[model samples]
Target: MLNPVMNNTKWYELRLQMCALVPPPTWSTFSTAGYRSQPDREWFYHFREGGYEDILHVDIQVETPVEREIVRSALKAVHVPGEETPSGFRVFGYLHDGQGAGYI
Candidate 1:
């Protein structure tokens, strides 16, 4: 069960944080802020073991080159490693670059 008030407040906070992090001209819009269920067997096992198990996906879409670069840079600043290729997007754990531990 989700608490309406708490969820709404948290959602707004997240939206603001994202807007600040990406700013204008970099993130045209931020959408799909919601909760997701945990994977099947893992969820069941966690429930049985009285442990916490769940995951949330924060999805955003970027449109322009400037926006894409801003997002990629921001992720890198936070040590969130991402790959840039002529193909498409990719996400992975943060990897440090030579610059005193920055994302790669």
Candidate 2:
């Protein structure tokens, strides 16, 4: 059984660390602080097995050149244990169990 509190905390810390690692360049459309503040505009989706898996499976549309480049770079730099598919990224492990994988 997964501990919801611990799972959320791990994912939150991971996301925050990733946001810190790849600070959006001045020329980019969004700021790291802004991105951190707004969950809707999150760089990646985090989920547990059998819980809203659809969020991870939805296609993320990167409209502009800047956005595309940033997304690509972030995905490459931020190590999320998962496979990137045509539809979306699929995470392969659990957070609460000390497994690295969590966010999509």
Candidate with top lDDT is: 2
Candidate 2: regions farther than 4 A off: 1-10, 17-39, 42-60, 83-104
Instruction: Compose the digit string of candidate 2's lDDT tens values, residues 1-104.
Output: 33222234444443454455334222111221222112233434432223331222223334456655565555555454454444334433223455444343
Q: What's the CA error at residue 31 for candidate 1, in Å?
A: 15
Per-candidate clash tally = 0, 0
Q: Which parts of model 1 are misplaced by more than 4 Å?
A: 1-17, 22-53, 81-104
The TM-score between candidate 2 and the true structure equals: 0.32
RMSD of each: 13.4, 10.6
Between which residue pairs do clashes occur in model 1?
none
